[model samples]
Target: MALAVEERRETVAAGAARDRFRWWGPVGVAVFAGVLRLWDLPYPNAFVFDETYYPKDAWSLLQQGYEAVWPDNANELILGVPQVIPLSQEGAFVAHPPLGKWAIAVGERFWGLHPFGWRIVVAVLGALSVLILARIGRRLFRSTLLGCVAALLLSVDGLQFVMSRVGLLDGVSAFFVLAAFGCLLVDRDRTRELLRAARAEGGRAGDELRLGGRPWRVAAGVLLGAACAVKWNGLQVLAVFTVLTLLWDRAGRRAAGAWRPWRSMLRRDLWPAALSMVGSALVVYVLSWSGWFASDGGYGRHWADGRAGLSPERTPLVDVPLPQVSMSWVPAPLRSLWHYHAQMYDFNTGLSSPHTYQSNPWSWLVQGRPVSMYWEQVPDGQRGCASADGCASQILALGTPFLWWTACFALAYVLYRWFFRRDWRSGAILAGVAGIYLPWFQYQHRTTFSFYMVLLVPFLCLAVTQMLGAMLGPAGCPPRRRRWGAAGAGLIVLAIVGCFAYFHPLYTAEVIPMSEWRDRMWFTSWI
Candidate 1:
């Protein structure tokens, strides 16, 4: 009796310690990520890769409520001492929606239109993403240790690190998508808790209980809409996640012992779910275009006024004739917006122009063709280059090789666990991967770069952390087995850290000897 009591006390103490670590551990990792991203953030003073387009557009949106034309030497002039921002009054036809530029504009508005200004907001979001992933992992796996591991892995990923430092839409949009996933996870837990509470109150197992408006689900919809406002790809994520949440609802009802759970799900949950997720998302998505709707100079803002464009009588891709005569009651602004969407769709699907850094989506997982965002060759004596030979500085948007390759195996293991063992956590992580990744396969003919894989990194980290938790074995496992598993998982993490350190220079555009840089390029394709 005495020994049992002591064991109980010890177990309770351990649980309390873990509970305390949960808050500090994830926050510590997030802080570390922030320092790495924000340190010397303005190193490459000039525009890197696509920075020229997005940052200028952000400035235009800040000034004119729409993307405006810039002078030919805008990049050079913007960086000049006097900072000549010669923006034209004419609006430019931007492909992406405006929210991401607005996100960048927030930082630029306060810090001035410089490198640090545009990149600051993205860097902060990137760090926050790490914290969010950590929290998500904790909730999914029920282990603070595993949550910290997931966050640490994301903090070191080269692609995430680089994207955070650059003024691009992908990183900001990724934050919203990940946040929505987190919200859905919370909604899942809340739903199960409510079902359990109803049972505790002596409610019948098959009772069609009405859970009041799911605020978490609604929040998720708003975040998804924000993601779509940043990029069209977010719509795919929104669709997949909507289906996922509904399936979760069905499962929840079934688990609550409801007979004919599918029927109950449709009758009781369908409308509410649709209104909460899809309806709210649609509203937010339309509201995100308020700037475009308000601006007369916005591209296609007046397309209904007899502009020289293809008639909206038919859809662009399918050539399906629309009943425009009957639908003429729709507002002219909405009509112009619909027409603009068609033009945007055509541009997005048809963009196959050759690019030096373009890579097929199939090769993305293997880091086959990392995009060279910025590169500069330098003589040995210039810019802290101490080598006798030439020096090289470059920002390569590549995933940490060891971490990503390990994740490939982890992904396979996660698939097995989800398919064969019916693990819900694995399925959730895979949902994110599928939603963010699978859609790109259809666009393989278009020019795509490996850097876009940044959105998929958090999910990959979760998969890896889950696999590591498995390696660590269950708490009831034999001592020897647990020891060996811990050793193996620890070694893998150490290897990932070493690999990240090895390639840190390429990620940050640090000047290094040409020979050293060449050595870091394990594959010629990476160059």
Candidate 2:
């Protein structure tokens, strides 16, 4: 009997090992994302959407610190061909910070500033996001295979795939957001193990167990900070993640038999975590703008007015004081830039344009209204040439319909586990959604688009696959049920892949007839 029990235990252990990373892994996810992003990359050959702004800014950033306008007809020149360095320093008004565009500039600088070269930065970042999501999911689900599956879904999603192929700021922001979330996951695991060990070793309240001495957590902080530096929306992740980390620390304290885990962390871990994550991020952010600070022609470069070289020195310029912001120490250009940011902030929150593609937070997960990035009327299928059949072709700004739909139901499961069972996994998923989604509610009146959800996609994919894996059951589940669940979920995945393929043309802006484009526009909002 004893021998039989031991053999059975060994069999279960082997099964668990099989599920860990038997097949799916980060490399597989990278390949999947790369295939989706790199195939037919130079499709329309023209810059799409706001590409008119970003790719040029990126190029300029590589050459100069600030955004400078290209020649009047430069758009046509920059479209399909690599060109010489543009020397004109005419100012261009831009909304977000420079880091994301600078990253894109790096690719354009190296690859000669064409569509693919400009977009290469976003594609690489998107690929990295897949790897990070896979690793994060592995840690979260405690199963590496499931983690890979999570990344696979994001790798193929229309929104994610399209964004990765374009020179957009959103995808870069998404990369940092996902990376930060992964870092927080590492912090959680490290802290948990430390908490467990301290209890095991009979450590006292004053005894510092050095729980989760995690460099990864610091990495997360830096990433989140970078996210913020990319766009202010990242501040939501910073605020939400900071609060969540503190709460986790509190829970860790209570679990570790500390009289005051929160207090202990306050005295020891909190400041260090802040400095590590926040400090590292601040340095990176400032460094991202090193070009901006170093150059005299930058938008806000005149702030210091020569008080301190490179540093925007604070100056008191209120002799004829206009407003309360008359700081003596802050420099002129810096102060002007500060005011510019204030105006930008108010503008961001106050705008209420009824954009055709603008979607509310509620519909994002289900993809109710996908933005249409590009469209054209193709005559009766000259490309495919079906005699009488008309095709509606397009680059629809939509996700894989079935994949996003699955996330809807999966998100519901996240809520169920978070509110009912207090599962930390559920909480973690919810925190991501909260960081991305909840803030949008206040901005509902603003001109927000569904594409903004791109940064939040990795976490949503993880949660969806996590719920799917749970439905598949563990190795201990009844054999018949486990087999049936795995089969069903596998079929669902197969269907999602099919949907991705069907939508691939639109995502990549491949030329199809107008009728086919109409067909892809499942809703009028998509048009």
Candidate 3:
């Protein structure tokens, strides 16, 4: 009996130590993520790719309430000399919503109009995303090592890195979406705590349903709203979160022994959930347009007043509700702005451009096609090359192969956990990918590219780490199984990091000899 007790105590102690492995893992992963993101952040010297759009648009937003037009060939002007280019008063019918543009503007204000300055915001946000995933993983897996693994995977994802180092609206959208996901996570813990408290308060939760006022739910709504303000696809994110949170609420009530879980949710969950998540979201979204609302020059600011381009059929009387009704004084620009949006929406939904980099939605997970952000000929015998033998060089925008490949398996694992284990962590991953990727299928004919998946990249990586943690089995599997699991996961991670380093030059637009560059192209599609 004494021997058995001592053996049991030893097992408990071992389990305790295993749990502690995650204590400092997040910090180590953080340092790794930050270092890789910050290195050569402003490489390529000039705006590498879409940095041309968001950074300039951000500057324009700062100068004006809404997005305004630039002179023809504005990128060249912005790229050269003084480098602080502002937009003209004429409104540009930007296809995307304004929130992301505002985020870029905020970055520009802090970092100045330089490439490094604009990129600083991207890097910071991307790093914060890593931290968010780490925290989420820690909470979900109850293992710090697992969380760190998630962060490490995200940090080394070539696509995420490149996206982070360039100014783009997608990063801003991703930031809000991740924030919303984090809020839901917080809500989960808070709800569980409430249930525990109810159980302890002599309220037998085994047969009685308990409900709690969830603050994190409100927080999630606010973040989702911010996402919508940033991009239209954010609407999809908001929808997914709404369902995911409500379902969580329902599950919470059921676990607490609510006699009618569905009824309890409908009665106690529906209204607050709607107002808190949906209503709060609406408020946040409108607030993102505050600059446009305040500025008289904003495209649609005076639409109600009937300005230029307002068709009689589309423009309603502006003074119907007002005491001082006078259509004679309405602004033309506002009317034009209203019409502009309708047209922009039409254009976006109807976009059918032949983009070389565009890839099908089915191909995104495997990275079947990499967008060529930039390419130039290093003529034979020229510019640091013995490439007198026809050298081919290009920046083929692609994710690190190891990172993407692991994500594939990770996502599959998440599917298993979501359905079989009914894990909330797995559900969150579903919400993110569904909102970001699945919707793209409907817009298959539209001009879309693989780079947009950068928003889902972190969550995809987290899915991978979550599986690794589960496979490792709570630090209590047979010694052989544990050893193999650790080794396998470690090797996979190391391989991903190695691949990231190998592709760093192409990702960062490093000028390489044609032959050397072509050597990295494992796929014809990559060219």
Number of clashes recorded per candidate: 0, 19, 6
Deviation of model 3 at 374, angstroms? 2.4
User: Can you rank all candidates by lDDT, best first?
Assistant: 1, 2, 3
**Model 3: per-residue Cα lDDT over 1-527, one tens digit each:** 99999999999999888666655567667777788778877665576667767777778788877778778778777667765465688766677778877777766787677777777777878888888888778887776767878888888888888777777777778888887888888887887778667767665453354455678888889888988887778888888888887788778777776677777778777787889899999899768777777777766555556333345443232313323333444465444545556656667778888977788888998889988776666666765655566554455568888888888988888899889988877887888889888999998788888988888887888888877776676666799888888887788889989999898878766667666786788888877
- Candidate 3's C-alpha runs over 4 A off are 1-24, 83-87, 202-213, 307-341, 379-386, 389-394
Relative to the unseen true structure, what is the C-alpha lDDT of residue 30 in candidate 1, on a scale of 0 to 100? 99
CA deviation > 4 Å runs, candidate 2: 1-24, 80-85, 205-213, 303-326, 331-337, 380-393
> Which rank order by TM-score, best down to worst?
1, 2, 3
TM-score (all chains, Cα) for each model: 0.95, 0.88, 0.87
TM-score of 3: 0.87
lDDT of the structure predicted as candidate 2:
0.78
**Per-residue lDDT of model 1, residues 225-308, tens digit only:** 999999988999999999888888888878887878788878888898889888888898898888888888988788776543
Candidate 1 ranges with C-alpha deviation above 4 Å: 1-19, 205-207, 306-313, 320-326
The models' CA-based lDDT, in order, is: 0.90, 0.78, 0.76
Top-scoring candidate (TM-score): 1
When 1 and 3 are scored with lDDT, the better candidate is: 1
